[model samples]
Target chain A: MVTMRDVAREAGVSKATVSYVVSGSSLISEKTAAKVRAAMEKLGYSVNHTARALSTAKTNAIGVVTSFRNNGACFDLSAGAYLYGIAAAARRHGYDTMLLTGDDGVEAIRSAALSRRVDGVVVLDVLIGDARVGALKESGIPAVMLGSPADSQGVDVVDSNFEAAAVSLVERLYDHGHRSILFIGWPEAVYERKLNYAVRFRASLMEACAMRGLRVGAVYAHDATLGASEVIPRALRDCPSATAMVIHNDAAVVGAPQAFERTGIRVPADLSVVTVMPDQLGEGMQIPFDSVGIDVDAVASHTVDRLVERIGDPEMSARVELLDQPMHVRGSVRAAHED
Target chain B: MVTMRDVAREAGVSKATVSYVVSGSSLISEKTAAKVRAAMEKLGYSVNHTARALSTAKTNAIGVVTSFRNNGACFDLSAGAYLYGIAAAARRHGYDTMLLTGDDGVEAIRSAALSRRVDGVVVLDVLIGDARVGALKESGIPAVMLGSPADSQGVDVVDSNFEAAAVSLVERLYDHGHRSILFIGWPEAVYERKLNYAVRFRASLMEACAMRGLRVGAVYAHDATLGASEVIPRALRDCPSATAMVIHNDAAVVGAPQAFERTGIRVPADLSVVTVMPDQLGEGMQIPFDSVGIDVDAVASHTVDRLVERIGDPEMSARVELLDQPMHVRGSVRAAHED
Candidate 1:
């Protein structure tokens, strides 16, 4: 149990010299190094593996910071794919991924960077004016966010084009002769937290509504299943003339058809639905949803690739990349009748 | 840039001494420390943040290694809860969680341990005879596995009671007067890989079936949805009189009833189905299967707790814990009759 201190004392040298000689990290004269080596032999001291790793190369690990709020206290289906994608991409880059879930947010991110546990950070579920972006920038650690904020001051971001999808969905319904539509958005907490995607999509929705002179009512829900209970009844009460709907919540997608069935409102016959979701839910319904895909894997790969590039060149200019949003307008929409 | 070497040279001290004086990782005589400090003032050498971190207390970070396989390189609904559970527990204990997904399983694990990136590791989706167990043991790093392996030589393990669930399920089917039953298991690759849960569950199923003198046939499929296609036709074609089925595949669970409906088979009228899954799927189905619950949160908490305890005492003998297996017998099973 000889400590490095004992070795230093035996060698009659400073502790840093002993470390330098053992790690081969710093330039030391052969004579001084020989003395440190001999002292180590005499004391039978072993270097900690951490010191050994630093001598050869970096940890070769990356940090991925996923929002604790995204999954709440338990699991959420949405965030899982993005995290898995990032890990797979990191592995391909010969780096292990470490998921950092710190409830304290920016401070926790600062700790991970300062500790040198990871080379760079990938922040998921990015919000506007995120404190972690500022923290990562100030620390000079390379970072990438999965969503882009309105202000791209110091952070690299990658996101899906939710704005385009929103505008197009609204416009497409308008062209199909639907004037009255109801928009089912995420819970108020999403926009209240000022997440980039939620805010941007809502803005785009409003822009389209204004341009087309369409009458639209918006509502929010937290749970998809229970959300439908509120969405259906409220849709009828608030926008009774509505003939089309643009839905954003996945929970609502899974529950809305079932809810409509119980309420005696059939898809296309009473109301048409367009949504952003995976194809599995869309294909399973009695009437499939006209849907836009969420390319989580593409988002993960782009974010990781950018972070790796930034890690190699810490001084590189930060950039934002948004993947194209593609829509699959299955037979969920129909020509609307005059109300 | 002025380096620690410059500080050491000016102070006429070894590099380790400068690091010791700056990081304060080790004690030095006040006179020697003062000399190094004066050299730092003369050379204007600033300590890097990494060195600054080691000067403080622990990093307060724990590494959780999840097999990218669990999520299937993207997203799998199954791995979500386990990961979410681990993150929640780590937060409660004031430990930041780092997810490690290594394509090279043992080497990646060894890398994490040797680099000193984490205080401890929580490995998920553990396999029997896993090389990581021996590697972690030899390295003397505190580690825990979500599933116990066949050999518990050095590492601690915590898992859901899959074996108990399997045995109980088979025995219950027998109690319901099911003499001839068909057993549908996970893909053969799961067993071929020697995963502890799959191997143990199948073994327990066999043991229970043997004791009851019931005739059972087993089949395996990779995809759960398509698995129903193969399983349904194969079961009745092979066993012919299999009045009950024990299903363990999630995809099969989601798809089997739909398959049954298309084939015009009524549940409990034509065939009985018993499964081990979350209640949500069963309750939402056309016919709810007799179900057994998987307590992923409990397993995650147990795994994290042990890793934390081991981090506090690396010398503690390793242990394995299995949480309870709870079952809900919906009306999916009925008394078997001689046709």
Candidate 2:
């Protein structure tokens, strides 16, 4: 309950000097700042953030609106990594993150902004034509979307280019002399929800395959029901001539070794396997496979940077940013002629 | 910036009535509350949370302090699950979670509490003799610990009983006529940090093995350098007679199939495997294995409940609650006689 006045008196300085030091103002001399800090420590004086926020009309907090609907027993690894990146970056900028996980993302975001609980907001798991985008624009809050919506009007967007990764992955497989390929996608539910990343990846991969005049087959693998074990064999059976497989599902990729073992398929011998997922997930897989590594940290870091900039200058123009990740060739692809 | 007075004048009600409605007080009549709400909507009068917090001395936000140091490219699934649970629960109680992740946990916690940025705090990944425990106690804040420290004087704790799970796993293995067992634990770095869960699990497992007079060999597996592929083979070589294995590492359990395939050790054929992990992780494994299922949701839910309670009534007594999780017997373990 010690106030700044008590510290100022103890340090033999004016109250304005104590305030300047507490607010990190560069106007104060180093000696004066040190004296104020020492007095604050001795008097156990701490700044009341609420009162300061009221006076400055700014809260050193960011609202992070994310959805956990798709998460199963195991939380989504990619989402978790992005969240870690955001929290770390926010801390570096002297901000805390207020996590808002209400099922209705638009309402959650709108409320946070209207209440002035945070200076800016970060939206995660953006869907095609997401309602949150409209809400954010209407709220007039400095906002950033971790995933791109089909139509983003006023918010900055930072996301991994899954569409590019998908297209590039197909080209790599085709260059390996693989004429026919089987593409395993995420659960039907994900696409049904109109999640931008999965839908975009599937469309881009198919477009790339058609342009190459390559024979391709596709199947949707559900995490709970149609897992890798069932999806992998069914795709192979339907496309008997397929010599390679491209999996865009994290669970399917993690479970690939078991699927191949049960179906009696040898990697790079009978079939070539490539996955499009974050490198973090690929590293955890029991067997290494060729992958287009999505850098979740990069996307998150950029989103935070843009949002912080917009918060500082609300007139900053909004733009879309799609980061290109690396392609890791871990010897899981084989030449069709050799096979 | 429409103020409460604007809404009050538009509604033809007293400013105090609008204040009561904004604070969610039941003293306001339903008709007056409806009028105030309609006026607020028409005038676009949003509550200024900072000003309200200065007057009411409540933020309706909880601070969640967690560490991500152990995470590699992939985030820890269990920690992520716990975080999701806490956020979901907090939202249900009309509270947002303020995530504070700093390497110096004590400083992060003390700053959040002393600044009154949150109504309460929930600390994750508590270490043995954690410095944060002392800081929290000294700060005299309403706090809860998701993991128990060796000396928790003034905090409520909610954690899964890893010691009990370890003891039960050993007993189950022993009952299957296994004498010698190989136990692979988390990375050496985790133990070096004195993480409460890993340190407690290892100690309890060793203690239980001794009680049953079972021969056990232990090794620390690092996620980066000494991964499962290297640790599993080395442990097998050192404990050649080991007919059973208890793995307390998530990465090691995940990579068991690859290690077994390379080492020519078949599950339930050459060795029986039992893992100590959350059921969420157990379900994600390509190969299902025997495991003690840690209910991360239950722990997180209880921790939030207690923390909220303490926030509401600061005089609430502190107590420790250890949740007993279920054991799942998959096809990974087999009788030694059958082998």
Q: Pick the candidate with the highest lDDT.
A: 2
Pull out the clashing pairs in model 2.
none
How many pairs in model 1 have backbone atoms within 3 A of each other, for residues 3 or more apart or on separate chains, i.e. clashes?
A: 12
- DockQ of candidate 1 is 0.19
List, residue by residue over B1-339, the lDDT tens digit for candidate 2: 778889999999998989999879759889989999999989888888888889889898898998654543324656667777899989878888988898888898888888898999999888977899988999888899998788789689889898899999999999999989999887777777888888889999999999999999988776632157778988999988899999987767766665676667788988899988876666655446788988777788889999998888988788988888898888888888634
Top model by TM-score, which number?
Answer: 2
DockQ of 2: 0.51
TM-scores for the candidates: 0.71, 0.94
Query: What's the distance in Å from true for residue A138, model 1?
Result: 5.0
Candidate 1 interface RMS: 6.5
Q: Which tens-of-lDDT digit does each residue in A278-297 have in candidate 1?
A: 44333323226788877767
Task: Score candidate 2 by lDDT.
Answer: 0.83
Looking at model 1 chain A, which ten-residue stretch has the lowest summed lDDT? A278-287
lDDT of 1 by residue, B63-172 (tens): 77766464221124556556667887887887767667766667656766655656888887678788778877776668888888988786788888888888888888
